[model samples]
Target: MTVAYVAVAVLLSIALVGSGIAKLTRADQVVTSLTGIGVPLGLFPFLATCEFAGAAGLLVGIWWPPLGIAAAIGVVLYFVGAVGAHLRKRDFGGLSAPVVLLLVSAAALVLRLLSR
Candidate 1:
């Protein structure tokens, strides 16, 4: 169970850290996507920070379960908002990614809790 938890967390952290860096770097693709979604450009930095922090927390949580649990919870909430945003725009096409991430985060959270 611990190995499975670590594997999932590492995968999530890699994806999130990469995403956070892209947002911070203002990668053209990310900017374009955000614009299409009607997300405020100004919010990118803040969002990126949260992602980076969450990723860090997940990594750190390997040795400290509570932090990992908190990070997983945070990521779940963040993805929930992302899903809501896509829904508001009626972008069903954009729903899958967030929904998948939300599921992963939720699963990680549940695993973390059960570990305790």
Candidate 2:
């Protein structure tokens, strides 16, 4: 159980950080997708920060279960919002990524709790 949680946490952390970096750099793809979804450009920094913080919490959570759980929850909510945005914009094409992230984050939350 612990091994599973660790694996998922590490993978999720990597993904979150990578996404955060893209947001911070304003990668063209990210910018295009976000802007198309009606997300303001100014909010990119805050969104990136949330991803960074969630990644950090997940990494530290390997040793501290509570933090990991909280981070997982935050990540889940973050993706939920992402999914919502896509749906709101009727951007079905861009929906898969956030949906995948949401499922994975939810998995991390359950795994962390069980591992604890």
Candidate 3:
């Protein structure tokens, strides 16, 4: 079970870190996508920063369970907002990725809690 938890955490970290880096480095693309979804372009960096923080927390949590749990919870909340944003914009087409990430983050949180 610990192995499984670590695996999920690592994978989720990869996905999130990759996304964060893209948001930080690829302003034009991120801005366009956010605008299409009715999100403010200015929010991109903030979101990216959250992602980076969550990713770091997850990685650090491997040694400290509480941090990982907190990171997982934060990620879940982040994705909830993401889903809400997409829904508000009626951008169903953009729902899948965030939805999947939400599920993954939720799973990680659950697993972490159970492990503790």
Candidate 4:
């Protein structure tokens, strides 16, 4: 059971890292995409920073388990919101992927919580 939680944590970490990197490195692209969906361009950089910070926390946040958990929860919420944003824009290419990621991250957190 402990091993399962570890694996889930690793998976969620990777997902968070990937998403964070994408958002951080491609802020303009994200801004454009979100603009199409009616999201405010000014918020893109702030959101991107949050994503990056959350990912970093997941990767090296073992020193503060509660903080790590908070980061993971934020990522989960961000992904859930991403799915909603995509859906609102009729973007089929995005809806399922982030939802799956969100579920996996949340499941990982749950497993960790239970293992305690």
Candidate 5:
């Protein structure tokens, strides 16, 4: 079960970390994608940085519970916002993937918390 949680965390970290880098580097592309979607381009890098930190926290937390728990929560919060944005865009197709990520992250968090 610990291993399962760790595995989920690792996968989530990969995705969230990559997304952060893209948002930081490709703000224009992100702005275009979120076109007329109300999210400011200026905010992309900030949010991306948080996501990246959360991802790194999750990784470091695996060996250190306190950080991992915090990161897990942070990532889950990030996903909740992601789910909201996707829904707001009426992009049901796009919503599914993020939903899965949210669920997996939530599950992993639960597992980690219980383990401690």
Candidate 6:
């Protein structure tokens, strides 16, 4: 279970960091998707900060269960909001990524809890 948790945490951290970098760089697709969803471009930095923080927490959490648990919770909420945004805009076409990330976040949360 610990091994599983570690693997999931690492995978999630990589995903989050990659996403943060894209947001920070204002990748064309990210900009388009975010603006399409009505998210302000100015908020990109802040959003990236959240992703970076979450990734850091998840990585550090491998040694500290509580931090890892809190990070997982934060990440779950982040993706939940993302999912809601897509749904609110009725943008079903762009919903897959958020939904998949939400599921992955949930899995990380559950695994972290069980591992602890």
Best by lDDT: 2
Q: How many residue pairs clash in each candidate?
A: 0, 0, 0, 0, 0, 0
The sequence of per-residue lDDT tens digits that candidate 2 reaches over residues 28-63 is: 999999999999989999999999999999889999
Q: Give the CA lDDT, 0 to 100, for residue 86 in model 2.
A: 100
Listed in order, each prediction's TM-score against the native is 0.93, 0.98, 0.92, 0.73, 0.84, 0.98
- Backbone clash pairs for candidate 3 read none
Q: Rate the local accuracy (lDDT) of all candidates.
A: 0.87, 0.95, 0.87, 0.70, 0.81, 0.94
Model 3: per-residue Cα lDDT over 1-116, one tens digit each: 67778888999999998898878777676666678987766777898999999988888887899999999999999999999988998888878989999999998888888877
Q: Model 5: per-residue lDDT, tens digit, 1-116?
A: 67977888898889887778878787565656655456777888788888889889988888898888988888888889988998898877666767987997798789779767
- Taking all chains together, the TM-score of candidate 2 against the true structure is 0.98
lDDT of candidate 1 at residue 3, scale 0 to 100: 77
Q: How many clashes would you count in candidate 5?
A: 0
Model 4 C-alpha lDDT per residue in residues 7-90, reported as the tens digit of each score: 777777776666666666665665567677777756766776776776666555445567667777887788888888889889
| Candidate 4 lDDT | 0.70
- Between prediction 3 and prediction 4, the one with superior lDDT is 3
Off by over 4 Å in 4: 27-33, 40-42, 60-63
List where candidate 5 sits over 4 angstroms from the true fold. 27-29
Which of 3 and 5 is the better model by TM-score? 3
Candidate 1, residue 41: how far the Cα is off, in Å: 1.1
State residue 86's C-alpha deviation in candidate 5, in Å.
2.4
lDDT of 1 by residue, 1-116 (tens): 67778888899988898989998899997887677789988999999999998889888888899999999999999999999988988888778878998998888888777776
Q: State residue 75's C-alpha deviation in candidate 3, in Å.
A: 0.3
Q: Give the TM-score of candidate 5.
A: 0.84
State candidate 4's TM-score: 0.73
In the predicted model 4, the residue pairs found to clash are none
In candidate 3, stretches whose alpha carbon ends up further than 4 angstroms from where it belongs are 27-29
- The count of residue-pair clashes in candidate 3 stands at 0
